[model samples]
Target: MDGRASFRRIAAVLGVSEQTVAHRYRKLRESGAVRVVGRLDPCYLGHAEEWVLRLRCAPSATLAVAKALAQRSDTYRIQLASGGTEISCHMQTSDQRARDTLLLDKLPATRQVTSIEAHQVLRLFRGGPDGWHTPIASLSPEQVTELTPPPPDPVPLDLDDGDRLLLGELAHDGRTHHAALAASTGWHESTVRRRITHLRASGALYFGVDFDEHLLGYSSHTLLWISVNPAALDAAGAALARSPQIAHAAATTGPTNLMATALCSSADALYEFITTQIGSMPGIQTVQTAPVLRIVKRAALL
Candidate 1:
């Protein structure tokens, strides 16, 4: 149901009435525990590079720095790491020059941060909110097959301005009604439907389900930085991608070639995963874990 936004289709898959699916979706939405938001494909927006930034700031400047970073258009995810003096953020940008300005020019000038390390993501084994295989709700294979959306297609580097409005609405609510979209885009309901279909087909848009893992009984989340032999990078990334506890993983440049985040039920669970499963995985050279103290921003929304 997380990926399947259509109530009618969900009803068909679950063998429930359409009305029942609609009622349940409404309840879940109103509960403030779950949200389905549309995320723009960075490639479609001309962003070909992604970077993870780790910043160590003075104690008094931690919150101030986080607030500033969270306000940037390129920043997709921002968090305060456990020590309360460190901040971690993920961003995507189109131009290397712009990235340099943020990393080399503007950030250093801020004077609040004591140190900054930027890691360039190389390949995404599993990244983003929807890339992982962990299931908050279980559905049969047949049901999932029926609910799966079509594969993405390539789109132009520059998206149309009108489509941006549609994307904005979808960002807030992936299942925004056609009539509402029409009102926002100044188009007919039919046009809104056609445009959305085209956007999805062109890979300009994607939907992700957002929820608090703590609310789902997973109380701990840890971000991991792992170093691996150059030849074993893919192997390490693929292994983490297969773990049910891993929420996000990617190959990147810098001291650590891979970065991953996992959700666990408790500190002991996180330790077990790191020591037993990950420790046993071949090709892994070193692993460093950082607990997330708070998430300041997620996706494109705060």
Candidate 2:
């Protein structure tokens, strides 16, 4: 669903009053059960590279390290996993200097960090603007069509200082009204709206939902580090991306070239998915599963 859609449009599709929809949404947001956030594609920012970092830390220091990483502007999806002994997260760096500063200097110097491994994301088979599709389908085809935004245009958009200001506000709250955006960006409300539309159409910005998956009946979250034959890497990634259990999948530079995050209802359900969906795939050499113990940060900054 388009996060920018008005309450009236959402209520019309759900067969509810706009007031009810608005009230419910506010309640969810205030309770920290759900949030809508605007995310920028790092690729659009020149020289930016995304990496998946795995940090093995002392058991007693894992939470501290994870929390520290979560506070960084460049890190998101921070998780404590492997019996609270490992930390995993996605990091974006604007340039080689930024990358080296962390990967080579900061992380290596951390006393509690016993080891660090960084995998450069080569290709995204899922995640990013595409997002994860819930296994449970609630909307009718007609309603889905009504809510879906149009395909983004292929044109490139260069971000200016004013555009960055607008994005900074949206990053905090995607549903912020145009007047607030205008105040932040120092642009007229009409200009802010037009710029937002242009940014989305250019594929530079997208809105994503951050929610507590457990509240929605999904209790199992596991990360899979998969080693696949180079010959079948693309095919294997595409297959993983098609699985409803996978929220994110990508080809990365590492011993395990393919990585995925699976969300399931229970340990039994996750076992079934691994054995049937992943185990049956061709060219799969090895699979390492890391159950996420806690999420310190999601796709958006907290």
Give the lowest summed-lDDT range of ten residues in model 1. Answer: 127-136
lDDT of 1 by residue, 120-192 (tens): 8878777653465556466878777777776867767456788889888888788788998999999999988
> The CA-based lDDT of model 1 is what?
0.82
Model 1 residue runs over 4 Å out of place are 1-4, 15-31, 43-46, 95-98, 153-158
TM for candidate 1 is 0.88
Tens-digit per-residue lDDT, 1-302, candidate 2: 68778999999998999999999999999998889889897656545788999999999999988888888788889998999999998998676777788889988999999999999999999888888867557888888889888877756667789988899889889999999899888899999999999899888889988888998799999999999999999999999999988999999998899999999999999999999889999999999999999999997745
In terms of TM-score, how similar is model 2 to the real structure? 0.97
TM-score of each: 0.88, 0.97
**Candidate 2 to native Cα RMSD, angstroms:** 1.2
Model 1, C-alpha of 301: deviation from truth (Å): 3.5
- CA-only RMSD, every prediction: 2.5, 1.2
Q: In model 2, how large is the Cα lDDT of residue 174? A: 96
Best by lDDT: 2
Clashes of each: 0, 0
